[model samples]
Target chain A: MNYRDPQLCELLAGQYVLGTLSARARRRFEGLLPGRPDLRRQVAAWEHRLPEVLGQAPAEEPPAAVWNSLNRRLFAEAATTPASAPRGLFERLGFWRGWAFTSSLLASVFALALLLGRETEIPGYVTTLASMKTRTPMWVVSASPEMDRLYVRALLPMDVPHENGCLLWIKPEGSDQYYLLGSIPEHDGADKMLKIDRKMRPMLKGELYVTVEPVAKGMPEKPAVAPSFAGNWVPIKI
Target chain B: MSSTPEVLGDLLARCALADRAAFEKLYRLSSPQLFGIVLRIVRDRDIAADVLQETYVKIWHRAGDFRADLATPITWMGSIARNQAIDTLRRAEHRITQADDVDEMYDLADDSEGPQDAAARERDAAALHRCLEELQGAQRTAVRLAWFRGMTHEELAEHLDTPLGTVKSWLRRGLLRLKTCLEGA
Candidate 1:
């Protein structure tokens, strides 16, 4: 579509404001709007003309809880979130500083066995999977000493559409390769345990990743979508 | 309505500076209409409340991006509420199932307009209403359903029991006519 064409621009802008454009087309239009003042003006004109349609709907006061929740979200909680766990991953990383904060309280706890001489029954490795940008923790990945079983627990709300499951991946420290660990269950927020073969266990040592993939695809050779969350796994000395 | 655009714009500007008092004032002034807009589409109070909360959070963070010359404060805020509701609707396993009950849920015939509507009716809204009346009956219905229900072309076709192509044409022609009429008004 030639957005520079005045007729097309007006029609697209009208459809965009009317909410009749397809999701992909709407996103494309939005991406184009920032650079095109003519398109921006068209969208603004459409928005200006449409609010009355909104006014036709009679107004009803929301419950007091709505305002309370907003206040808590914008003030009470945001103030305390950074103090407790460093609210955003971008701040910690510094390179990607302006990304939106998606998750919260990303605490990576390492419980190493006190005595290396004794055979420890606890999990051999554990790491919290978090977004690199938001630093908000989403899932906890833990592996048994024998590397036979992996446990994943969702800590935040995840939108997994039907027929799609979260697939876990691992990239060793110096290697560029991403090995598929397996698919974790969707957002039941329940602890999901996946049986892992001996071969895939050692590959889980470095960075952990969780990506949304089609269930039919099984484990792809590489991630089909960008990893939703990522974290580094560090060994704790006893 | 007691809060004029200038006041709301000032409050939004203050909110951009992270003033809590300004945020609260903006919420108190703007949320009712925003909530109404969201609730009309989502049709569930809990979901509407959640979307409204998210909308206000965005407003708080992105308040600085708002340009008063481009859109009214309410329109800018209301667009966020509507977009959030649309996102929720798209992401839900079962899309909001209240298409049949939108009129009842919104009380479309309730003539007790709020002060904001009265104030709006004095200006652009009045022109819009007059222009909307000029659309053909089907065109009017098509535009209203798309606006109020957040129905995409496919969903609108399903809801209206009309063919997809026909619905698309209705929307395109209706919106084009609306644009021309609104511009003239």
Candidate 2:
């Protein structure tokens, strides 16, 4: 559709403000509005002129819990996340400033990739997750974008509860949502080549976390509780 | 918490600066109408509350993007709420009410006019109301249901007992005419 056509712009904007656009269409239009001043103006004009329509709805105060939870979600969440072993992967080890340590971590990741039969140049993203308390690498996680594969190597024994297992989470850059990669069962071999959802392959560069969640039944669609572990992928130019 | 656009816009400005107090004030002032619209559309209070939460989260994050010149505070916020509800309704396997037998449900929908309606009426909405009056009966009702109930094209078609194409043309025509009428007024 030619958005430049004044008539089409007006119609789309009006339908948008009138609350008739489909969810998909509305998102597409909204996605377009940032670049289209004419469309934005039309949407604004409809909103400005149609206050009566907006006002015709009956007003009901939302439950107080709504505000309470909203407050917690936006404000209090960071302070409350219990980190039994909470740590950022690089900062705690001081790898950020110590070039030798960071380089060795990179080398470890490459070695693991080689052991997994992946091309050395094709390890798209890799990270070493160390236990916050132990200050020793616990897991070396890597993703091969070319094969859409995720591999986890247990450098140290994971001491999760018998009933619970490590739940891997992929958080794309700038997103609050955590996409479940897969579960790492208790008996997951020392070097387990895990199958991640192919959709998450491209999004693997942002962050990777392994939270302790129940995996007895299967991987729950979402983590049952707040994530305990928070860490990012080791960015690899290769 | 009652406020004019200037006050609300100022609150929004402060919210943009990451002031929780300003965000709370904005929510307290604007949430009644926003919640009201969301509840009426999504119909389930639980879902409505969830949708409202998402709406305010977006508003808080995007408060800096508000252009005071282009839109009023409540309407701008209300549009976000409405859009979120409609989007939720589409994704959720919500129910059949918005489909086949929609007219009775549309008429019986919880909200038609309330304090906000009267308050908005006394404000400068007189010209817009007059403009709305000029659309044909079907167009006016379709527009009203779409606004207040968040009715979709299929819902409006079923409710109006008209063909889908006819309903779409009617709504589009109604909006075009209203655009012309409102711009003139």
Candidate 3:
């Protein structure tokens, strides 16, 4: 393949940008891009030109939760693989799998609770811890007295600064385990109701710990920030 | 033109450095565009969000690879967004063909303006949008196939069942027209 032919390059570039290029052809082009500047130029030209055609696409705001989850994943990656970046679905799955073990544990609890008469208390006044300096809240922490459910609300006000999405966690005393409640919305002043089974709910000792992890759309997870909010369980005085 | 491309590009660059600020900025600037494009292709908000996150992860790692020569920041970002979306569509077993799909794909642009961009994009999008309008049907098809589907000539040929020469010609003429149109705009 003559990588230098302008017309051939443009033709190939157009197709590549259009995504009509075969998988094999794309690999070949990617192989050429690093070694051949001219090829890269052609590809770039197509990229610059084609975006207008895509203009008719609707402008949509992704729920902030996506960004929040992405940050958690990226930060988590930074903690474990700071030097070597995680890539592709398998790597992502590995990240999710590590968290899944905890989810599975929750699932097991759900099964047990359903079978027995064990009742779980819903958390009240779920609040995210604010940043020490800016006092900006970073995660969404919620409480639900309803067993098997989490009532989530973005604690940060509409104007308060924070990431778009967040990671939910519950730390019950004596368990040494952190319960993952997936991702939730952050920016908009809307409350999200999350369902938690026996496996997902932290069997709290009245006082429970909650944390949020920040995420973005493209990057890996950042570090899990320290617990932003804490609640105390007041024993019922008989 | 909206400020999306440049903002996204800037954020992408910052994200490469693991800058959360950049990541947040990028999300604010481009998530709507990414979400819009992906939602159009996938038609599911939840799945679109998943794709959006994955796309950003790719962007974080690959943002450094972005070249001023290959595409404008938005185009480059758009390419990533579109490709990830189509990949999800394929993975979900949506068997829609290319020709029909392009028609649906191009409808994502908003003629009704909302956000604003830098003066350069204003000039660039005007020119690019016009050039896109001037393209012949075949030329447009070739461009869309390459850009949106990430298809190569051979796959395009196979999918369209057209002669290789015809495909090449359409793509060439289409690109030239686009260049001229963009430059003039």
Winning candidate number (TM-score): 1
Top-down TM-score ranking: 1, 2, 3
- In candidate 3, position A23 carries an lDDT of 57
The digit string of per-residue lDDT tens for model 2 on B1-185 reads 56667667767765543457668889888888889888878889999999999999878766656777788788788888988888888789473463433345444444344323356556646676678779898887787778766778987888778999999999989988887886687
Q: Report the lDDT tens digits of candidate 3 across residue range A59-126.
A: 87789799889989977886787534443433343234334433543443333334332444434333
User: lDDT ranking from best to worst?
Assistant: 2, 1, 3
lDDT of 2 by residue, A1-238 (tens): 7778888888999889888888778767877776677788889988866655334456789999999999989887535752122123233222232344366577777677578665445577777654322234556777775637777776556678778888878767667678888775434337677766667667766655567867788778777865544445645675
The C-alpha RMSD of each candidate to the native structure, in angstroms, is 19.6, 18.8, 15.3
Best by lDDT: 2
lDDT at A181, model 2: 80
TM-score of each: 0.59, 0.57, 0.53
True contacts kept of each: 0.54, 0.61, 0.71
What are the clashing pairs of model 1?
Answer: A89-A134, A103-A136
Worst lDDT window (10 residues) for model 1 chain A? A94-103
lDDT of 3: 0.58
Candidate 3 per-residue lDDT over residues B105-170, each given as its tens digit: 566456555333446556666556667779888777667655544455665677788998898778
Docking model 1 quality class: incorrect
Of the candidates shown, which would achieve the greatest DockQ relative to the real structure?
3
How close is chain A of candidate 3 to the true chain A, as a TM-score?
A: 0.34
